[model samples]
Target chain A: DQQVKQNSPSLSVQEGRISILNCDYTNSMFDYFLWYKKYPAEGPTFLISISSIKDKNEDGRFTVFLNKSAKHLSLHIVPSQPGDSAVYFCAASARGAGKSTFGDGTTLTVKP
Target chain B: DTAVSQTPKYLVTQMGNDKSIKCEQNLGHDTMYWYKQDSKKFLKIMFSYNNKELIINETVPNRFSPKSPDKAHLNLHINSLELGDSAVYFCASSQPDRDGGYTFGSGTRLTVV
Candidate 1:
């Protein structure tokens, strides 16, 4: 079963605009949600994360919003730049799980 | 310097052949893992080791085996390779108790013909 899901396979946005990526999860036991960005041939790099206790977390240009009631989370990038074009993957983990389950991933293209 | 590195970036082999992928991490983390990314781009955990001890072993096939000689290295070996086994394998490491994200290697593309 897919515990985490990214409905949008791809997204395109103009540079200097805002880009939003959404993710959903079926497991309510998950308390931690994370987002990772991946280039064409490189492994995924961690971007930002939010704990279940917090509704939102911001890191400079990136922000993550979590809704425990809806079992959903979103990653938002403001003033998106061309360098931000990459695949974004959403993952979740529960306490003592020892590992995180990843979504199928969403490709984001920030046009110049 | 690269934190996590895996060898044999691309491996193309015939069916029934045995192969191995080596991984090493310089971050000095106590936990290491092996994840497989299928054609659908779903990253699934295969095995996890902490301080050279097997911690988590997902329901992977018996043909696949993971070995960790130390805390910083983990290797995967496959016997009787099949076309269905073709995928990109990634190695990652993390501090077992820390909340930070895991560091992943570039990944190895294994193609079984």
Candidate 2:
């Protein structure tokens, strides 16, 4: 069973516009959530994350909001740039699990 | 220097042949993991090791074996490779307790002809 799910397979947004990516999880035990961005051939790089205790976390132009009650999370990039186009994955990890479960990933295309 | 590195970026071999993928991490992280990205682009965890100790083994085939010589390295060996084994394999390291997230290798693309 997939504990983490990114329902949208792809997304497109104009440059300088807001881009939002959504993710949902089924496991209530997951306490930490992370977002990673991956290019065509390279591996995924960490983007942003939020703890179960926190509702929102921001870093520069990227922000992550988590809702524990809904078992959902989202990544928001304000004024999306063309360089932001890539596959975004949402991963969730539970306490003492020692490993994180990843979603199928959503490909984001920022048109310039 | 690369935090996590995997050798043989691309491997193409005939079915029934045996091949191995080597991975090493310069980072002194205590946890290492192997993940496979299939044609569908779903990254699935194959195995996870903590300080050379096997911690998590998914429902992967028995033909696939993972060896951790130390905390800094994790290698994957496949016996009698099948056509279905073709995919990109990624090596990742993380400090689970620190919540620092994971660092992944560029990935090794394997194609079984």
Candidate 3:
């Protein structure tokens, strides 16, 4: 069973525009959600995360919004740059689970 | 310096051959994990070790085993390799699964013909 899902296989955005990636989960027990970005041939790097207690968390130009009721979360990057072009993965974890489950990932191509 | 490192960035072998992949982390994490990403890009957890103790076993086949000689090194051994086993294996470490997102190695691409 896929606990976390990223419906979009790919997304394209022009430079300086906003890029948003979405993820949905079926596990209600998840209390923490995280976002990671991966470049070709490289392992994923942590981006931002949000706790179940908060509806939103922001770091620099990246923001993560969570809706516990809908079991959904999104990552937003404003003023997107070409350097941001890469695959983005959304992962979720629950307390006491001791491991996080990752979504398949979405390829984000930020055009220059 | 690479926080998490794995040996054999690329491995190609014949079916029924046995092989091992090694992993090491220098992030001072007590918990380590192995994840497999298949051709379809599905990431699945295979095993996890905390303080050199086995914690999570995801119902993998018996032919596959994970060993952790210490808190920082975890190795995966596979017997009778199969074509279906071809994929990219990644090693990751975290203070604890819940408190951290995990630091992953570049990955090892394994292919069986």
Candidate 4:
């Protein structure tokens, strides 16, 4: 079973526009959520994360919003750039689980 | 220096051959994990080790074995590989607390023909 789900396989947005990626999870035991960006032939890098206690976390142009009640989370990149084009993966882990569950990933293309 | 590194970035071998993938982490983290990204782009956990002790072992085939000689090294050995064994395997490390996200290696793509 896929505990984490990124329903959108791909997304496209114009440069300098807003890019939003969505993810949902079926496991309520997950308490921490994270986002990772991956490029071709490279491993995923950490982007942003939010705990179940908080609703939002922001870093520079990237922001993550977590809606615990809906079991949904989203990543928002303001003024998207061409360099932002990559696969974004949503991951979640229960406290002390020692491992995280990852989504299938959503490929984002920011057109310049 | 790379935080997590895996050897043999690409491997192409015939079916029934045995191969080994080596992984090392310089981050000094206590926990390390192996993740396999399949054709569908799903990253699934294969095994996990904490301080050279096995912690999590998913429903993987018995042919696949993970050996952790030390906290910094975790290696995967596959015996009699099948065509379905082809995938990109990633090694990652993180602190036991897990407050921060994991650091992953570039990944090793294995193709069994």
Candidate 5:
């Protein structure tokens, strides 16, 4: 069973526009959520994360919103750039579980 | 220096052959994990080790074995590989609490013909 799901397989957006990626989870025990960006032939890199206690967290141009009631989270990149094009993975982990469950990933392409 | 590194970035071997992927981390993390990214692009956790002791073993095949000689090193050995076993395997390290996300290796892509 896929505990975490990224329904969108791919997304495209124009440069300098807003890019939003969505993810949903079924396991209510997951208290921490993370986003990772991966490029071709490279491992995924940590992007942003939010705790279930908070509704939103922001870092520079990137922001993450968590709706605990809906079991959904989203990543928003304002004024997206071409360099932002990559596969974004949504991961969720229960506290003290020591392991995270990852989604299938959504490929985002920022067109210049 | 790379925090987490895996050897043999690409491997192509015939079916039924045994292969191993070596992983090492210089970050001094206490916990390490192995993840498999299959053709469908799903990253599944295969195993996890904490301080050279096994902590988590997912529903992976028995042919897949993980060995951790030390907290900084975790290796994966697959015996009698099958065609469906081809995938990109990633090794990652993190603190025992995992409050911060994991640091991942570049990944090793294995193709079994």
Candidate 6:
């Protein structure tokens, strides 16, 4: 069974607009959530992360909002660019679990 | 320079053949892990090692084995490769302090026919 779920397989958005990706989890033990952006033929690179203690974390153009009570998290990218057209994966982990559980991934295409 | 590097980026072998993928990390991280991404693009953890010690071993097949020679190196060896073994195998490293921010290799695409 998948502990982390990204129901959306793909999303399209216009450049300079907002793009939101959603993820849900079944495990309450997961306290840390992370997002990674992956290009074809390459490994995933860290995008953003949020801790259960905090509801939101932002870095420049990327922001991650966590709803602990809902066991859900969403990643928001404002003014999305064509370079942002890549697969995004949501992952969750707990302390000492070391390993993370990753969703199937969401492909976001930022149209130009 | 790539922090996590895996050699032989692509491998194509016949079924029942044995193949091995090597991975190394330059960062002085204490933990390393192996993850598999299937055709469906689902990423799953296979194994994890810390200081050359086996830490987390997922519900993987016995044909797959992970060996860590040093803290910076982890290798995956698969025997009797099956058709379903065709997938992208990723090697990753994470510092214990960063929670779970992992540095991943470019990934080795293995195709078993």
- Pairs with steric clashes in candidate 4: none
lDDT of each: 0.95, 0.95, 0.93, 0.96, 0.96, 0.95
Candidate with better TM-score, 3 vs 4? 4
State how far residue B72 of model 1 sits from its true place (Å): 0.4
Off by over 4 Å in 6: none
> lDDT tens string, model 3, A8-109?
999999999999999999999999999989998888888988999999999999999999999999999998999999999999999988888999999999
Q: Would candidate 5 be rated incorrect, acceptable, medium or high by CAPRI criteria?
A: high
Q: Taking the candidates in order, what DockQ does each have? A: 0.84, 0.81, 0.73, 0.87, 0.83, 0.76
Clashes of 1: 0
B6-40: candidate 2 lDDT, tens digit per residue: 98899999999999999999989999999999998
| Residue ranges of candidate 3 with Cα displaced over 4 Å | none
Please give, for residues B31-77, the per-residue lDDT of candidate 3 as tens digits: 99999999979778999999999999998998899999999999999
lDDT of 2 at A39: 97
lDDT of 1 by residue, B15-106 (tens): 99999999999999999999999999999999999999999999999999999999999999999999999999999999976377889999
The better-scoring model by DockQ among 4 and 5 is: 4
lDDT of 2 at A95: 89
Give the CA lDDT, 0 to 100, for residue A76 in model 4: 98
Lowest lDDT sum, 10 consecutive residues, model 2 chain B, at: B93-102
Model 2 Cα displacement at A73 (Å)? 0.5
Task: Identify the leading candidate in terms of DockQ.
Answer: 4
